[model samples]
Target: MSCFENIAVEDIQSCINAEVPSGISEVNMNYAVHADIATFPVPLAIGAVGYTYAKANVIEEDIAFTAGKGFGKIKVQVNTGELTFDGVGSVGNMKQKSSLSFFIPSNDAQLLGFIRTRLNTPMVFAVPERQGQNRLLGDKFNPAYISEVKGTTGKTGEDDKGVQFTVSSFAIPLIYNGVIQEPAIIP
Candidate 1:
């Protein structure tokens, strides 16, 4: 019943050598302010079988969100979106810090309004990775927040002009196993 007990060592001998695609193709953004359910995620119980660090840190159950309370899908540009994890393994705090970065091409009044609302809102981001894996950042306990938003109108016609968003959270991200249901954008 000890949390520090040694579990079976995982073996990587059967791993295959193959090229895997990188970078996020899309991000599902969920605002905590608009969520009907509480933001805190259900924590996994200790002593559960096959409870690894990756599984123990995140909720393994599917999240059911009502209409208009579900995630909003954002398509990321090629090579424009990525999530990074940084953590300290000290005894005092073993928490991990994760950051999600992506660019939204083009800027309009409607987009500005949406960006305004994100500045002060708590959020959760689900990013799709290779091999049909969905990675979730920001649980209920550690909701993500917009750390920075940089917009630029390029001087040259060929230069990129858009807004880049950096969403960050102090909680370790999870490998999502459930489907991400998108809410109706117009409803």
Candidate 2:
């Protein structure tokens, strides 16, 4: 008696209601060729996010050191200061060294060429995270820089995103204007 028995009205309603599902809207980067740190980042190829993909790897290492001069009172001291291993921390092992690396897709030729040309220059990257209801939830933008471009490559493997890339966002800064991944934000 039913022509479309598999179709449900609630499923249809749910799909229609789920507008802001938190998808990768856009990811773009710009570089300054042999430019000073004070210089603003110029768009590499303007607004182009064709087949865009981006990733960042953040590494945080623990800090540890020894603080004490000589083995004992009789040992005496040759150096003025205590023998200590230089590490990141004010007091004890309470600091971590953090660094970031990104894997970006070479979607546009002009942008890829810019990256190749300025492979050794300081660059600023602006990445925007937008959703359908970003207007209500307050979208966030992640900005970072690479002091020196360490590696460059182009490869195609059996399993790759059109081409080879590398990076994973870990210990990366995420300044949330409001709670993002929540039931209400996406709903």
Candidate 3:
């Protein structure tokens, strides 16, 4: 049995554009898998036995926008999973830990550029709710909110690929309420 047996394509599409702001000529969203820490060692060892394993499961949705004059934003959300580890031997054992984190900072210009460039094009994005609905959708789904442009690429020391944008604003549809709300700084 499939979980999406009664979902309408239009309804799903509607959810996609539910957060687009007014005056924005166009909007788009792309989904991608940002796998981090594919396998990490668990801190569990005994006697002469040792074990290590790490796994990261995350589904990211990248929302792109083009409100004229190159002014746009990319909002990404991550659904994370726990880390698993196991080790059993005559003289050894193993352990591991996992966490889910998705928060983008507000001063990463390079990361913003990278996302805008990669997600701006047309590509097949995965729909987490309905895995069978994996299809190519242009960057035009408006979200109910544009949380923050965060980075999950992890820390790279001096390399610092861990830059992200903390999006605290979003554009919702007028049908849900009255007039559209103007952009206000989130404190």
TM-score of each: 0.81, 0.28, 0.19
Worst window of 10 by summed lDDT in candidate 2: 69-78
What is candidate 2's lDDT per residue for 102-125, written digit by digit as tens?
A: 333333565455446544433222
Off by over 4 Å in 2: 1-24, 27-112, 131-187
Tell me which residue pairs clash in candidate 2.
56-168
Evaluate residue 134 in candidate 3 and report its C-alpha lDDT on the 0 to 100 scale.
18
Whole-model Cα lDDT of every candidate shown, in order: 0.71, 0.26, 0.27
Candidate 1 per-residue lDDT over residues 1-187, each given as its tens digit: 7555765455445346777778776544333333544333555655577765556766656767655666766765567888899985797768799999988887877667878877878777887775567777787677788899988887899988888989888877777776565665643
Query: What lDDT score goes with residue 75 in model 3?
Result: 38
**Candidate 1 vs 3: which has more TM-score:** 1
Per-residue lDDT of 140 in model 3:
25
Cα lDDT for residue 98, candidate 2? 26
Candidate 3 or 2, higher lDDT: 3
TM-score-best of 1 and 2: 1
